[model samples]
Each structure stands twice: as structure tokens, then as C-alpha cells.
Target: MALAGWICLAGHLCWMTLQCRSVSGKVLEETYTKWLKYKDDCLRQIQQDPQPAVGLYCNRSFDLYACWPDALPGTTVNISCPSYLPWVQTVQHGVARRRCGVDGQWVQYSEGELWRDISECEEDQETHTEELWMKQVMLSFRVLYTVGYILSLLSLLAALIILLSIRKLHCMRNHIHANLFLSLILRAVAVLLKDSLLDQHWSKPINTHADVQHILSHRAAIGCRTAQALMQYFVLANHYWFFGEAIYLHSILITSVFLDNSKCLPYFLLGWGTPLMFVIPWVVMKLLRENKECWAINENMYYWWIIRVPILFVSLVNFLIFMKILKVILSKLRADNKQRYPDYKLRLAKATLTLIPLFGVHEMVFIFATDEQTSGIVRLIKVFVAVFLNSFQGFLVAVLYCYSNKEVKAELQKCLRGWWRWMQTCWEDQ
Candidate 1:
């Protein structure tokens, strides 16, 4: 039954496909649809050669019967820009100014020149320079994000192995860490795959934004959509596990009413199961929405925010619980008898540093304001800060909870000694 359930879940996830309806998409559809109809007519005529002609030769003097390039009567040919340049627009993103006259033939460049497209998209020096600078800065951020996450993954794996290997390290607290670490690993993988999907699309040069859209429409668009959903899922799972971290502390220090490990039950349920409520609605809405995007990144941004509310609530509740736990610890600490609980205060402090940065609740600072409105140096700075903070989350957690923990440090030292003694014995035997 468990295996059957897993198969059903996989089938459901694999069935979704994305469709987009951007303004650029509409222009592309019209441009190609016109040409395709003309090609079909030319092929059927079979006058001499069967292939459709690019354009017909016409005299400079207007001739009443002069044959022109195949086009609708009284309609100008609309040429869309290449996908790499920008978009098919009059002002921004790259636009073209080639038109076929009433003769159904393409207009010439001049008396003796071939037609040349009037370039406007990033045509100005300032706009082109700004775009180049933005691309370079984004490239740097991608490098930092990828390298940092990979390093964090390696560190988290090493910490988990050490925690599980030592009998002394196996505790409820470490269990929470294990779950959070796993969530981090999964989220990082999903984000990497999402970026990889975009790389595959834009890697090769395509003639128009329409071509890029068409390629994505027919290709593995579902893969990109699935990556996005999984990223959302695992990111939330990581935050909820942080909530579990706070809950664990709350149980240990404030609420002594629960039996040993009973608190873990609620943590497990919330960490794994609560996301289903958010993800289900987002998925169903995406599948049913009229938009073309395989994912829910639409103009109104409703689909994206559906999951955001839950994350905000979780982070807020966790923060409150964490503060209460800290208050309880301070209240329990007697001033004159402070030496009695020296290690207790240290544990509280470590937990504070560990949970806050690990889950990135402190990132609430920039959550409301992305760099969409800003430009120039301000946008670059915002991008840098966001990337730097998010990239180092797993690193901070692993360093604080595993590397800095006294028990883990002592266990690691013992492990090195064992390995050293084994090496020495092997040398003697040789």
C-alpha cells in the first residue's frame, strides 16, 4: 500500500505542463502563423520549383502586376526579434522595422542596399552598458550561490554522519538538526535544477522570443515547473524544521508538562504534513489557471504568495516561541546562584544563534522589497545582500550546531585519536 501510494504521488506530479500567455507570445504566434499559411499556398501552386520563395524581385518603378513577397493584401510583414536580443516590441527589449508593401514583397533597404533592421532594443550606449553590467553582476551572484550551497551540502553531510555515528550524539536535539539539514540539502538541489532548466533554454541563440517560447512549450517545460514546486516545498520544510528546533527548546526549558520525546510528535507532523495544505492549493490553482506559465509566477503573483503566507506565519510563530524560551531561561537564572547554571545559559545562547540564522527569519528585512523598482547601484547592492545572506544559511547552521557544539567537538577528537592509533598499529605490523 505504501508503494502504491508513492506511485500515485509520482504520477500526479509528472502530469502537469506549463502554458504561457505573455504579450510577446501573442506577437510570435501572429508572426509565424502568417508565414506558415503563405508557405502552404506556395508549396501547393507547383508552378516551377515547389519550395516557397523568400521574396520576389521587383523593379524600382511601380508596376501594377509586379509580384511581391507572399503576404496578406494591405498587410505589412511583422518581423519579430531574435529570442536572444530582447523581445518583439516598439520601444524596449528589441524591436524590428521591416515591412512588406502592398505588392506582397519585402521593402528594399535603399536604391542598392539589402534591407537592414532598425535596431532599438538596447541600441543606446547607456542602456547597452547597463545591461552588460547587470549580466556580469548576476553571473557573480550565480557563482556565489552555487558554490556556497554546494559547500553547505558537503558540510551538512559531514555533520550528519558524525552525529549519527556517535552514540552520545544521538539525542532529540540532534534529530531536529538532522531533519533541518536534510531539508536544506533538498531545497538546494531543487533550486540548482531550476536554474539548470533556464540555462538549457537560453544557452543557444534563437532568432526570436517566440522561438524560445516555442522551444520551451514543446520541450521539458514540466521539468522546470516541477523543479520550482519542489524548491518551494523543501524551502518550507526547512523553515518548519526550524520551528521544530524552537519547539524542542520550548519543551526542554519552559513547558515541562509533556513526557520525554512527546513533543517530537507535533514537530514531525507540522514539519512534514503542513506543507501539503499550501502546495495542494498552489498546484491545483496552477493547473486550472488560464496562464501559460507551467508554474505560478504570474503578474498578480497570487500563486507565489499562497505559500508565502504560511512561511510568514511559521517564521513569526517560531520567533515568538523562541523569545518566550529565552525569557524563561533568563527568569530561571538566579543572580547570586548564577554559577549553578553556567552551561544552561550557554546552551540557550547557542540555540538562539543556531535557529535564527539557519532558517533565515532575519531575512524579513528584504522580504517585502525586491529590486524590481530600483536600478543602478542600489539594485546591485540589494542583489548582493540577498545572495550573501541566503547562500550562507546552511553553512552557518552546520558550523554552529555541529562544529561548535562541545559534545560533537569532543566526539570528533576521539574519532581522530582512534584513526591515529589504528594507523600506528598498521605501521608496526608492516
Candidate 2:
């Protein structure tokens, strides 16, 4: 299952990367074309009525006459003045020209060929702007891609550890494992697609603002929505599995009534299938509203909110139910004089308590904290907090429920010991 998950994740990542590259390329092409058109318009306007004396500024300090011999289109020309400053600026039509000489003293360029210098300055400015924009984009891409890649790799390692800990694949852990794998795969793909290949290919020129917006809207609306829905579904399934774990513990530890009910069939379906019913509405709404971007709340915000409210309410209810079951199990253990089980119970309780506030109540806070009236800094902080909390939920569950369990720890240690002995024997033989 873990291997399967990794394969799926890789495939999705490749697809998303390709899609992003394609979209980015289209955007960049459109932008460049628009910029070309703007440049052409400017040139045409200049030809209609040439200015007598155009002053070009260099690096905000030096103003000089811009004059060139030839009318070159789609090329850059470098002109040298008495100044050695490494900055340049241009003004198309003006009389006041400033200049800095080699001595670093400011002077005015009252006479000289102005048109050529202005053209060169404009060309250099455009080039510099493009380079700066590309550098900014590349920096953003590196950070996003690096973080995403590391997380995906670590998730794969965690999955492998889980799979190797058990002898058989069909177990409670396996069910949770499947959900985690699916989530990691989809998220990795989404990240890779958005950050890497697509962004590189699609460089939007300034004039193609509408096209860029259109592409961004479509990608955010459709691509991001699909990814978000999948993530939410997987999260819901994983939590359901945790709830199942609690139920199984209750049956075995407190009472034997549900021993037979702990089988994988019903739990498996409920874990994977139940979220679909809730998710269907969002998917249908997305398709129907197929606007530029996917909105959390659309034209029928009330209707959508009504649907979402129940899901949130149910999650809280299930959390409460899990807590009650946990309390009962712990009480029973304490009465029976089982120290080990009671300690385990305490751990489970702590995990549940932490999660309830983290996932359930925190969401409400996030919603309330967001407002159009809020200052930009406050809004930014609120958004960051919400996103961080939401992502943290999945990771916390994996750590607290699976990695922190004594039973799981023992099994993992045994597996590692065996593997270590095997490696030792092989080394000795060699």
C-alpha cells in the first residue's frame, strides 16, 4: 500500500508539474506579446511627432541627451557618457537632462543627440525589469518547491515505516496509511505543478494582465479546488479511522460486544466513502459556478455555508463521542488496576484533547478573525494562522496516534532490530 501510494504520488506530481509549466508558458507568451504591442505603440507615437530634445535619466542621478543614429526595433544599444555609474533611466520627451561625470559630480545635459540615448535607456530599463521579475519568481519557486519536496519525501518515509512494522497489510494501521498516502500524493503533485514547470514556461508580459488573471482564476478555481477537496476528504477519512481505532480499543478493553463489529469492511467503507457524500456538493457547485476562480463561498453563500456548517458540526460531535468513549475506557482501566492501559489511555486522551481545539474550535476562530474591515497586517496574520493550523492537523494526527503509541513503538523497534542483525550478519560474511 505504501509503495502504491508513493507511485501514485509521483505520477500526480509529474502531471501537475506539466500542467503548471504549460499554463505558465501560455501566460508568459501572452504577456510578452502584449509588451511587444505596447512597445510598438510607443514607437508609433514617437514617430508621429518627434520631440526636439528628450532628456534621459540614468540611475536617478545622471540626466543626459538620448540620441541614436539608427531606429532599431527589438534590440538594445549601450551608450557611454562621461559617467561610470552603473544605473540608467529614460524619459521619452523632455528638455531637462541630468548627467554625472567620471568625477561623480552632477551636471545637466543641455545639448547632444537625445533620441538615441533615450531609446538605449528605455531598452536597458525594460531588460533590467524583466531580469528582476524573473529573479523574484525563481526565488519564490525555489522556496516553495524545496519545502514541498522535502515534506513529500518525509511522508513517503513515514509510510514505509508503517508498512514495514506490520506483517499483514489488511489492518487498522493500513487503512489510515492508505488515506495518508493519498493525501501526500495529491499535495505533492499540486505543489510541484504550481511551483516548478508551469511557472517557468508561462511568463506573462505586462500587457497581458487580463489573460494572466484568467489563467490564474482557472487554475485556482479548478486545479486548486480539486486538490483542496481531495485533501479534505483524505483528512476526514483519516480522522474517521482514528475514531475507529478508539472504538476498537473500547471494544477490546472495556467490553467485548463490538469485537465482531471491528472488522475492516464497514470501517473501510465508512472511512473512504462517507466523505464523498459531503464532497459531492462542493464538486457540483464548482462545476456549476465554473467562473474564473473557485470561491469558498459563491453566489449562494448561504446554501453552501449551510452544507458546510453541518460537516463541521458533525466533526465536533464525533470528536465529543470519541472523547466520551475514551473517558469510559480510561475509567474502566483505572478500576481494573491496569497501569499500562491507563497510561495509554492518558496519552490517547491528551491526543484527542489537543486535536479537538486544534481542528474543531480553531476553525471557528479562523472564520471570525477574517474581516474586510481588518487592517492588512491583521488580515495577513489571521490568514497565516488559519493556514498553519489547518496543515498542522494532519501532521499532528499522524504523530500522536501512530508514532506515539507504545504498541506501534515496540513493533517498530523489533523490526529495526531484526533488520540490523541481518545487516550485521551480511557484513561479517563479507
Candidate 3:
């Protein structure tokens, strides 16, 4: 019986350590908010002052029961977070026990009013590394996302202006390109607002997890929520455009059928209109079902999952289509049939190569990244890869589909020569 009890205790301790390792900002914030609320609840008890709750300690152990100084003898409490301040459990001694002392002042930490011990908040090497890794991944994402999204937005706009300026550039593919670019622009704007406004939203510096949670909970605006929805909608829309491109390529390559206006009507509907199938339902669900302050916009809850499910499906379908296109291209290459119709086949092949990567089928590589635990460096690298693929994809599309086109180069050269000639004429007149 003694051995069994020891084994059970050890198992429980191991479980605690597992729970405490590798924390997330959201979970930490939520747990801290709850902890603060608990303190506030206690302070309100029997008309007690708020200050009483700040460092309220009891004879009870910190890890297993009530924290206030006057709790019953058998009660236990859990001590977690950093020794200075913690909202949730971490690998840093996440689960420690504190039992109430019979004499009524929580187990000693000081000679004066400070009162209480947190000596057990020690972390093992693995847990310490996990904590560092989590911080590294977060810092990487924060820095990379801000830089990549902003620059991608600017380049996307430049590409759109170039495409729209020349009369000869108008075609079904350009129409698709225009829509894709617009989606990216809106998504970038939405993400920029969300990221940029985060700091200014709260008056305080948000030094703790609880502070972050509090600001996130209260920072809901109709405009911001709508922008979030719009961003998600457009993000999915852009992916669909990639799927559309794959389908178009598959058609042109396999069947040799050009994308004409009549054939493109369905593609347009699928590209521009299909996202509504997901976004409308998400918006309606957010407005009608969710009563919270944030309204499930930034919260990756039910509505967000609804958006994600279709995107995952769209990604899978596009990948299959892309794979099929590759097979056909490889078969064509092996046959040497391109020699019979060199120019047309070569252009088609070049177009396929240029546009394939921009479709973002490669994003699947990072989809399951967070599902498993890895070292911090690996996580950061995966984040960089995913961020680069998703964020800068629009810029790549703009460059490949519009700027790099032979016709666009000729048009640009023509415009520059005309400007040069006008300058010379002005000089002669002078």
C-alpha cells in the first residue's frame, strides 16, 4: 500500500509537470484573468477592501487550496507562474503544494507583511528550454508577420497598378489576377489594423498574461470585428483563386482548351462568389450566436473553424489538381511532342512553372506544425516558412502574372521611350 501510494503521487507530479510545460500566451492570459477574478471575488467577500487580496496569504500550502490567510487547516493551494507574478502554470515549478499552517499566517516568506513562500517554483532543463522556445517562436512570428505582410501589401499594390494601366493586359487571367490582388490587399489591411492597434488598445503596458487577456476581451469594435471577418473572407478568397489557377492550368494543359469568357464565368463565380459560402455563414454566426465582447472574430472558435474547414478542403483539392498538372507536363516532356508545336507549348509550360508555386499548395507542409511538440528553433523556422509562403504569395503572383509578362515589358519600354522623346522635344523647343 505504501509503494502504491508513492507511485500514485509520483504519477500525479509527472502529470503536473506535463501540464505546466510549453505554455501559450492565450492560455496563460486566460488563467491569469481567472486568478485575478478570484482575488477580486475574495476581496469583495464580507465587504473586505481590494488591497487585502493583493498578497493575501494563508497557512495553507500555495499549490493545493485557498490562498487567503484564514482558510481551514486541511485546505491546500497550488502555486504557479513566475515567483514575481504568474497567471498560469509553467514548467517553472508549475505545480507546488502549500498547506495551511496551524498558527494562521501562510507558511513564512518574510519577517514582515510580505508573507509567503514560492521556493518550489524550480524548472527542469527540458521545461526551461520549452519556455525559451515558446518565447522564441512568438517573437519570431511577431517580427516576421509584421515585416512580411507590410512589404507584401506594398508590392501587391504596385503590381496591380502596372497590370491595370496597360489596355492590352486585360484578359481572363488578368481578371483573376486583379481579384486575387484585391483579396490580398484587403487581407493585408485587416491584419495590419489588428496588429497595429493591439498596443494602443489598452492603456496599460500589458506586462502580464492577464493584462493581455483583459485587453483582448474588451477591445471589440464593430469595425474591427468586421475587418477581421473581411480579412478572413479575403484570405480564403485568395486561396480559391489559386485553386482557380490550378484548374485553369489543368484545363489548358490537359485538354488544350483556352480559358474564354464563357468558360470563365464559372471560374469567376467560384473564385469571387464561393468564399461567401463560408464567410457569410461565419459572419451570421458571429453576429447571431456569439454574445461575447470580441464576438468570435479574433477568437478562433466555431466561426473561424468554419472558415478553416473549407480552406483546408480547397487546399487539398488544389494540390491534387496541381499534381495532375505536373503529371501531364512530365508526360508531355517525355513524349517530345513539344517539338511539333514549339512556341505555343513552350509558353504554356513556362506559364505553368511561373504560376504553380504562387498557388500556395505548399502551405500544407506547415499546417500540422503546431500539432506536435518540437524544439523552439524548429518551430521558429516552420513559422518563417509558413509566414513567407502565405504572406508574400500575392507579391509573387503579381510579379509572375503581370510584371514579368512579355507584353508588360514591351508596354513599359514603350512608355519610357515616349517620355524620353517628349523630354527631348521640350529641350529642342527650349
| Candidate number of the best lDDT | 1
Q: For residues 206-267, write the lDDT of model 2, one tens digit per residue.
A: 23235445545555345545555565565555445544554455465466453355467765
lDDT for each of the candidates?
Answer: 0.61, 0.47, 0.60
Q: Write the per-residue lDDT of candidate 3 for residues 1-430, one digit (tens) a residue.
A: 2132223323333333223222323343444456456655545652553333444345221221223334544456554533323322454546555455555444444553333344454445587576556656666676777777787789889888877887777777777677778777777887777554433332334333344455556343444466567777788888887777777766766764434534668787887888989988988887777634334324545565787788888888877777777777667665665466546567557756675665667767866544344455686678677777777676676677667878879887897898899999999999
How badly does each model clash, as a count of residue pairs? 12, 25, 21
Q: Which stretches of candidate 2 lie over 4 Å from their true place?
A: 1-157, 168-170, 177-203, 209-260, 294-299, 329-382
TM-score of each: 0.70, 0.51, 0.67
lDDT of 1 by residue, 299-324 (tens): 45667678788887877877677677
* Runs of candidate 3 exceeding 4 Å displacement: 1-25, 40-67, 70-129, 206-224, 254-260, 263-267, 286-304, 334-352, 366-382
Between candidates 1 and 2, the one scoring higher on TM-score is: 1
